[model samples]
Target: MHRRRSVVLTALTALVAIYSLVPLFWLVVNATKTQQGLLSSFGLWFGDGKFALLDNIRQTLTYDDGVFVRWLGNTLLYVVAGAGGATLLATLGGYGLAKFDFPGKRAVFAVVIGAVAVPGTALAVPTFLMFSRMGLTNTPWSVIIPSLVSPFGLYLMWTFAAQAVPDEMLEAARIDGAGEFRTFFRVSAPLLGPGIVTVLLFTVVATWNNYFLPLIMLKDPRWYPLTIGLNSWNDQAQTVGGQAVFNLVITGSLLTILPLLAAFLLLQRYWQSGLAAGSVKE
Candidate 1:
């Protein structure tokens, strides 16, 4: 019976992998084709004599006076600032909730969990209005401010901190004359590395791929991230006199995901260690 279960589980995993990867495979395949070839050729394979992968990439990066480069830079800025801030706040807040006693602790946790349950998209309009009232609309702050708050990151760090950080270690630090901030930075921070990496990765992906918030928050082309920029290309393709740069769009998308893929590959070890450590208690 165990053997049969293992076989079924392996099959299910394989199926899920294929389901997730097929679209990525299609994206890569189509990214190599020209706009005409993309429309005419098979989506999963190369077009006959129309392999323009390098050209498509060149066009993507150089198009519209190199607006794509600006979009890429904006994305990097948002991800670094937004994700870094979110992870820092989440780590400190989560650790405090786990280790320290405060009035209304349960209420705070309950509110945080409830925030996690609420979809981010639902709050976009209200958030936009609030930011507009503060004269932050149409600016980078519009995107960065909202991206900094991560309820799920807080929850994950809270759970991980509760399990990973031992009271004895903290007490020993306090006894040895280490202040709260010093102890957290010198000791707890190192122990929390894996959890911090996990939260950072999550927020990075969230901020990197964020579209709806930026779409509503920003109207200027200069402030657009890759997501909005790519969609604008798509929209432009449908309009008269607009460049049908579908190939560039596809290549740009392919380029956009490379960093995320590299990040996962580079940080997989830390993420795996965090997951494994969190699953077992000492």
Candidate 2:
């Protein structure tokens, strides 16, 4: 019975993996096709024509005086500033909440929990209205400022900090005359590496894949991120007399996901490290 259950679970997992990968596989297949082939051939299979992947990529980069490249740069800028800031804020806030006790701590926890429960989508309109009043709409600040508030990241870090950082270790740091900042930097920081990386991954992904916020906030094509930029390219098909660059759009989509995949592959070690971090007994 246990063996049968294991087989069933394995089959289900395999099905889930396949389901997730199918779109990526289709994208890869479609990216290699020419515009003509894309409209003609099956998306899951290669076209009879030459693999136009390189041509599509070149056009994607060179299209509209290199708007895709500009979008890529904008995405990188948003990720660096918005996601990086969010991770830093989350780490610091989480660490403080986990380690320190002060006035209104319970209330603060309640607030954090409430914030976590609230979805970003629910806040978008109010955020838009508020930012509009402040004249921040249609600017990069609109996206970056909102991205900085990662309630989930903060909560995850808070829980991780509670477990990973020992009270005894903190007390020892205090005995050694280490200030709050010093102790955080020297003792707690190293131990929190995994959590930091985890939060970073979260923020990076959130910032990278963020579409709706930037879509509403930014009107300038030059300030567009990859998601919006690619989408605009795809939408060209609908407009009268618009150039159909679906092939370039496919290639750009593929390019957009590469950095994210690389990030996950590179940072997977931190997650692995987390699992073994507190398992050893001295």
Candidate 3:
């Protein structure tokens, strides 16, 4: 019976993996095909067309005087500043909520919870209006500022810090003449490795894939992220006289995902450890 269950579970797991990977596999297979090949060929397999991947990549990077490169740079800038800031603020906020006691503590938790419960879409119009009033619209700061406030990230870190960092350890640190900042940096920070990486991964992915916010916030093509840029390329193909650059779009998409894949591969260990710590009860 146990062997039967194991086999069933394994099959289900395999199915889930395949389901998750099919689009990626399709993207990889299609990225190698030319525009004509994409139209004429089977999606899951390579086409008879000459491998235009290198050519496509060159075009993607060099087209319109290398606008794609600028978009990529803009994306990186947003991810670094937005995601990094979100992680920092979440960590500090979460740690404070977990360890420190002050007035409005419960109220703060309620506010965080309420914020998390509200979808970002609901806040988008207000955010836009506020930014426009501040004259931050069409600027990188608009995107970065909104991205910095990650309620979910803060909540995750709050739960993680509460469980992972013991009151006893904090008391001992205090007893040892370690300053609050020093204790956090020297002692608590090491233990927070998994949670920090988890929050970082979340924020990074969110910032990297952010489209609607950047779409509404930024007007300049120079400040567009890869998500919006790729969509523009896709949209161009839709116009009556627009250039058919699906091959470049596919290749650019392939290029766009590579960094995220690398990030996941590198940080996967910490992410898994974080899940473990977050899941199990003491």
TM-score of 1: 0.95
Model 1, 3-44: lDDT tens digits are: 999999999999999999999999999988887887788568
TM-score on alpha carbons, each prediction: 0.95, 0.97, 0.94
**Which pairs clash inside model 3?**
none
Cα RMSDs, all models: 1.7, 1.2, 2.3
lDDT of 3 by residue, 203-239 (tens): 9999999989998998899899999999999899778
Where's the lowest-lDDT run of ten residues in candidate 2?
Answer: 237-246
Scored by lDDT, model 3 comes in at 0.91
Clashes of each: 0, 0, 0
Cα lDDT tens digits, model 2, 135-252, are 9998989999999999999999999999999999999999989999999999999999999999999999999999889888889898999999989988995577554687788899
Candidate 1, run of 10 with poorest lDDT: 237-246
| Deviation of model 1 at 73, angstroms | 0.5
Model 1 residue 22 CA deviation (Å) reads 0.7
Q: How many residue pairs in model 1 have overlapping backbones?
A: 0
lDDT score of model 1? 0.93
lDDT of 1 at 88: 99
